[model samples]
Target: MSDTQPPRVDAEASTTADSANAPRPPRLGGLPLVGSTLSIARDPFGFLETARETGDVVAYDAYGTESALVFDPEVVESVLVSRADAFRKGEFETDFGELIAPSGVAFTEGERWRRQRQLLQSSFTPARIRSYAEVMVDEAATLVDGWDDGETISLREELSRYSLRVLARSLFDLPLEDDRTATVIRAANAVNRYASPRRLAIGGLLPSWFPDRVEREYEDAMADLETLVADLVAQRRAADATGDDLLSLLARAEYPDGSRLAPEAVRDQLITFLFAGHETTATTLTVACWLLGGDDAVRAELERELAAVCGDRDPTVGKLGDLAYTEAVVREALRLYPPATGVYREPTSDVVLGGYRVPAGTTLQLSVYGIQRDERWWNEPATFRPERWLASGTGTEDGGWTLEDDSDRPEYAYFPFGGGPRHCLGMRFAMTELQLALATIVRRVEFDPVADALEPSLGVTIDPGPAAVRVRPRREK
Candidate 1:
């Protein structure tokens, strides 16, 4: 009934036209309600199959609304970067607005997001992130010490806990031994559970509605998170500390006009960093280890590079870039299994994309997962290959892979951390953390896959399921 709604077509006329001229899109192959959901649950890669059948762009009607799905890199770039203002964070993000009400940079828009971004920029600068490398290496050492030789363990969980500790220490300057660590972890897990597909779908359908159980759980988790963050702020306030830790920096950060962040704002920023910073890095590290476990030659090459550069000294801020192989492995892992499976944006105005008229107000789903593995850009797209990144001639002369030749490619072809002015602020810090963790693990131990294949579970982030890998301390030559 709204003026912005797409023109409705009579069913009979639409069907007649479809039957006469157009190819029908891929339909749900299984039982009605279970079809697409079941496919997505079973294999994350099947979405691409559906896309192939449906053309580069498809529309899905879910939860009483229509949304467009785009897989072409150019279309993706158009939606994410080229005409970004026309779009805001779409359903996927808005669904959790209530849960992350005071969301710092993650959920804000326009002036608020811009101002907050400015305030936090210096905190994640290359110099600052480099300064934190020792902290990451030290934490990694503790994790290595904790592992028992020849043990088959779930590396995902171990890395998750380890990254959580490092983020707490390096970013907030909080001691890992702080009692609040457990509470923060619990709250993070609760948020993850509440952000599951079922919950997200429901939230998308009814933004203002909150189920009683979910509401209660979210409130409880928020309370715990609030207490932890409030305590940290109070501790910083009392000490008047001006240190390199993210918390200290935030505590001291002032606007251009000379106003400090309010307590609520600070709390939201902390929550954003706490969740966003650790989860993705942990997942990347876990997947990287799994990938390395399967490839003996790559693993040995990584070890050789690390030994040549580090020489028994822990990786320091100055030496992180020296671990080129380690950096490539991390980049390849991200390309293969990005932490955020998709990015969503809403068009501000009517625009033409990929020769199709995309009207304003449509929610666009940019499948980063699909774009990364698109065969056009990558040779042997499904296989794990780090060498492509190391080879100079692999990409085009313009500094992208062959898949990026079309004007549409660069804007959309590769967006692991996103692109444009709104690109991820913590990218530098994340790269440092990942490099340190990978170097430390590969240097101290060797891992072997326990199974023939590791299944990926699509969650808030892409997760490798129940990865049990055999580990042994490296035998010195």
Candidate 2:
């Protein structure tokens, strides 16, 4: 295969509609109009699994809306990278625009997105990330200190607090009070709980003006979130202080024309980071710890790497390269349960996908969850196996610490951090934080989870459902 040739996988889609002008992908769902929206919104992961069984590319009626779900890697490439110019952030993201605003980088596109990305790029560079590692390590160690040996802890809540604290410290340069941090965590979880796809779909069936408790709760959380940041920004402005945190970075940031982000825009960006960076990384850490808790061999191997690389000291960027197996374990956990369930984008103009001609403006849902779990792409797709990443040997040269490139695996198959130009900008920092936290925590404590099936509790990000771990110190301090 030529390097430029977009590598094709054994993925195919069933056509839903046949037309000389636009051939549709296969359809998956129930009766017309409402379609599969209810089923999908009720259990998103299960819905996607069923959709994939129907075809690699399948069309479904989501409430009054219609969308094509892309499970094939080639189609994902076309949508995210190849034909990226022809597509921009679409309906699904726009649905949450009120939460982050169009000015926020996550929801913006075109020139605005470019400028926003450029303005924010410096905050996530190698040097910038290295600077943030100390905050991450300190937060991880602090979390460790709180855990007593043989104490049963709720992984999700504790990790949520830890991740929020890290973001609060590293990005904002302010410490979150215990009460305030608890409020933040509670509000975030409330938003996720009520913002399910089913709720949105059901709500859509009603008038636009109809009251939505979950939506209201999510808004309340967002309001609390905005107030929290606004207060911090106000304090920073009053104090005339700008430290090394991302808040400091943005407050002091200037465009080429020497203009600064407006106050509201600054708040939007802060909330974006809080939403995008905090909960997702928290989910990653929580799930990683849970996954390791179940597998003794994996934990032993990771502990060995931690002892060899970090010894009794906290982990930092300088020691990341030595935490190969630890990082691989993170990647594998993400593959098994990606935080972001699906990716959505729309075509700017007409494009053909999966041998079916698709008209412009058709909303497409690229199932990241389904793609990563497809048996065709992974061996024992359902099992938690971190070693597959090591065997790939694609990124071990960096000691498996860097994000694994698409050299060994299909590019779109495992895009937990996303791909193309719009891929996550915080990838490096998130990876760093996860590796450091995993190393720091595992080095000091081992987790023994209570026996349970542990179904994924779906929310803004997937969480390990209701599983508590017994934290036991592995070695003397």
Candidate 3:
């Protein structure tokens, strides 16, 4: 499963006796029984930032679960990379049976995850993504075409819909009609809400077999989504479909021993891509726009680059290589509010992290949010400076963006996309789309934030909430 999958939180986990004598990480105090639930939910970004200062690896009790939150790059690397085999993704993997699709890559482990990753990896290659770029530009342009100058719009909501449509056209090779869009939205909304930390806290306390209200809602939404995906697959097969989109690629793929993905397997992957593919990019884009909207100098530089490189035309694939500044803006936005706030991993056996023992059943959360913002890895950590991504050696020379220079930095310090084998499959696709869409929209509209500061809605993704903006088309030269 992609790291973008809502972390499957295990509130019931406890460390073993083997780790009893290990140096304890500082704990953030919280209310009785409920622990730090309310505080974390109220301001996750703020909480993590403050918590990281307590120590790189700090313990926190949220919703009755004792978790060690890792913020240091070396420690984050240990969990996500070096000792990866010693840990498995927590509750979401062993639990959440049919709650999510039945056994997709995001939740699978060991050899199962390997097989699925290998099979799916072929469809997202650089060449395949290049072939898919036109669909991205067209979908983005279509969304921009619908906006009005000087009109206030929720960039989050609009881009959420746009990214969903882009996923359909670019990878799925389908354009969502109104009804289809509604179904997907319903499924996505329910899944995100039901999987939220608040919901997980409550749901984890109850017996697994108990039919809860949110579980019923999730099942209903999944039912609609599964039916839609199944029908699409069946329709393709009945017509002897021939195409190069991801759906068709998966439809025609085989197992090493001359077997095809099970009917349910196809459904699982389709649901994963459709549900996960759009939300992260949309969140990143909304946050990026808001950041740029509030900064004239950054926006002007971005505008200047767009004008110089794209020049009176929509951005084509070849021109994107010159859009270094625009790409940096997206990267900086991601650093501030990564699509996945934290990743959850549980050690199967006792492991040493930051000189502390994480015994079996103890859950470890790598706080991507805290690490990205922590000054240990950044210069002026809290600043929204896209120039952090630029260096002297690489430049367009015509005053466009210089190449990003972070050769001195550690990779784990700013991994908006989680690292190691389970890194996001859609990383390149999402990056390409973000740059094109941002360029397409900013080439015309300039955003002015409606409020002094936007607040984050830490749902399935850390969305920029309901922040609206007034967009006016830039005057023609």
Per-residue CA lDDT of model 3 for 213-271, tens digit only, reads 88788889888988888888877767665676778766665664667777777788888
- For candidate 2, lDDT tens digit of each residue in 1-477? 112222232222212232244545667757666788788777777777777877777777775676888888878887788767778887767766664554688987778778888888867889878888988888888888988888898888888889988888776778989977876776667666666676767777878787777777877876786777777777777766656567776666556578777766677787788778888888788889998888887887777666666666777789877677887899988888788877888876656676665566777878888889888888899898777766453433223333344465677888888789999999998999999888888877888887565668654467666568899888532
CA deviation > 4 Å runs, candidate 2? 1-22, 206-212, 242-244, 392-408, 475-477
Task: Report the Cα lDDT for candidate 3.
Answer: 0.78
TM-score of each: 0.83, 0.89, 0.89
lDDT of each: 0.71, 0.75, 0.78
Q: lDDT per residue, candidate 1, 1-477, as tens digits?
A: 112223322222232223333332223344344334444444546655575556566655444434566767766666666667667885656666556655578888888888999878867777777777888988898888988988998887788788988888877888756457677667766776677655555454455654556757867987988887877788897889667667887676556578877766778888888888877888899999999999987777777777777887777767765566677788889999998877777766555555445555666667888778878777898888777666445422222222113343354666889876778888888988998889888888888788888887675567676578988998675
Q: RMSD of each candidate?
A: 7.1, 4.8, 5.8
- CA shift at 233, candidate 3, in angstroms? 1.2
What's the CA error at residue 374 for candidate 3, in Å? 0.6
Error of 3 at 12 (Å): 28
Residue 434's C-alpha lDDT in candidate 3? 93
Superposed Cα deviation of residue 51, candidate 2 (Å): 0.9
The total number of steric clashes, by the backbone 3 Å criterion, in model 3 comes to 2
